[model samples]
Target: MKLLSRAFATAVAAGAAAALVSLTGTVGATAAGSGTAAAPALTQVADEAPGYAVEDFAYPDADRILAEQGIVLKRGDGHITLAACGSETGLLEVWARSKDKVCFRVSGNGGYLSLEIPSVYGVKGNAYATEVTMTVEDEEKSFDIAKNTWTPVGESADPNGRDHMLVEIRATR
Candidate 1:
């Protein structure tokens, strides 16, 4: 697929160059007939090629999230999007670190995302069948979240109330 895209781009560039050369020749011929008209300068045509391919798992707002909320969002499939917590109803709520809550809005029939928010202890789910993964120290844990309700996870789920980082969330219809 990558090779095909590159080849297509190369073909487009070659076509543009050919068009420029032909246009320059036409202008030169017209100018030679009468010294009145100035020969137009040769200009490279603009590329109409498509944008670079996107990585499916790349986080779109990782830097912005880190800067605004002090959370390092990693990679996700884009089904889940960051939202303003508690401000809207029916959104997934995540409690982490110093931030009061980092929110996510789920869409489509299912959603899957990976992120990094330290000291997560609780989450409130929406209408999707939800699952979340968290990590603490050398141990990792997974929790099944109740839909349309608040469910304690991470440190809250742990018997010792150990601090943990929310790592991933997957939701399905």
Candidate 2:
């Protein structure tokens, strides 16, 4: 009888230990499953730096050109770019200057540009059909520039020789 009682006690102890383990696990699972105030908050980081934005259309070498050439370049569609003067091939040369003429090389089928150059009364086009827009005081004029040749514009086209600013240029293949 003593042996049977000891065996029963051992079985009971084993069952009780198993129950305790199961209960502890159940409590942990229940706490996790509640899903209220159990998850930690996430901190988000910005993809880009603060106070920084990219300007895709801003002119290339703007600071240097503005400082050296005394001309202001604003924005464009990226098909045209400023080039050194006297480029032989594949260039749209603008021969307007207060002291010396400047030029730009244009590529691609067609493109547009916005710039600020005072006293640009004429331009020499390349292989592409070109057009230019100018503003004199409050009057705006659009000129259909000749291809591969110099065409008179602004004050050159105007009998009064009124000064004009070249504002835009468009070229097509």
Candidate 3:
């Protein structure tokens, strides 16, 4: 009986912890602050090719986390932006990007929107431009220029879908 009670309490605590985490946001990279880097730009002697031009990715269902706002992708100065669609069906949604850091990502709040009721969320957590987008929501905000492992997840259920995800940008690689 005591063990059972302990187990029940443990489950309740876990549920509460998960609730708290969801109340905040999922684990993903976030824009720290507007403040620029404190240290001076380090000089690199090696000459690397043009990095992160237009690219395509197969985002998994796990990375398909919801976007309260949408996802943004860019390479070099130019970029491409994709918004999340509300409906389950997918469609190609595209947008141009500004010049800054090539191969970078940014994500909108999810738990902030998910925590509220649908109607309340519809009013407060309202999702925009979710109907037409073919791409999935970007779940990976942690971009690595060196590893090239930072692939933001936008969802596409259609396995046979072609050109479902298209990213057009000028990269140094």
Candidate 4:
């Protein structure tokens, strides 16, 4: 029985040795210019890595929106977004002579959008406290809108009733 166990252990040891030699031989051959491809260098791997994504905050599909809707949507924090009027309740509404009506959906703790809509006169606020900036010629004016109510803005609020272009909107909950 002792001789049988000793022979089995010797066979197992020889098998393990052979496996180690086979593995090392392949690795050594690869290292010693044996036609096998080497691992990529750190610099080469880094150079092929994907680039970092950077957000410009510019409005997406702005040209299409401007061409289709006749409204210039420049940029925003993604909190305020254009929406079709009456699509849903609780949307901020703007009344303009050039565009007639434009609506925005507001979300998050606060929201802001920079845009251009000519001859704006009235605004209907949502749940947020809203403010709008308008420009007439070289003069600019701002109006604070009452929450969940309509407020006269731009040319309607102007003493001289000059046509005003809506430029920016800011809202806070």
Each candidate's lDDT (Cα)?
A: 0.82, 0.81, 0.29, 0.90
> In candidate 3, what are the lDDT values of residues 1-173, reduced to their tens digit?
99999999999999976875565464322346333335557998769976777443423221232243233332222121233443322222222222111112212321101111110000001222121122323421111122212222222223432223333221221
In model 4, which regions exceed 4 Å deviation? Answer: 1-19, 22-43, 46-50
| Prediction RMSDs, each to the true structure | 13.5, 12.2, 28.3, 6.8
Summing lDDT over every window of 10 consecutive residues in candidate 2, give the lowest-scoring window: 27-36
Task: Write one digit per residue (lDDT tens) for candidate 4, span 1-173.
Answer: 99999999999999986875677664324545464556756654464768889988899999999989989999899999999999999999999888888999999998889999999999999999999999999988899999999999988888899999999999998
Better of 3 and 4 by TM-score: 4
Question: How well does each candidate superpose onto the true structure, as a TM-score?
Answer: 0.67, 0.67, 0.16, 0.77
Per-residue lDDT tens digits for candidate 2, residues 3-109, read 99999999999997677557665422344454233355787788777996877898888889899988788899888788887655767766565735778778878
TM-score, cand. 4: 0.77
Highest lDDT: which candidate? 4
At residue 142, candidate 4 shows an lDDT of 90
The backbone clash count of each candidate, in order, is 0, 0, 18, 0
Candidate 4 collision pairs: none
The model with the greatest TM-score is 4
Model 1, span 4-35: residue lDDT tens: 99999999999976775576654334434442
Q: Which stretches of candidate 2 lie over 4 Å from their true place?
A: 1-56, 97-99
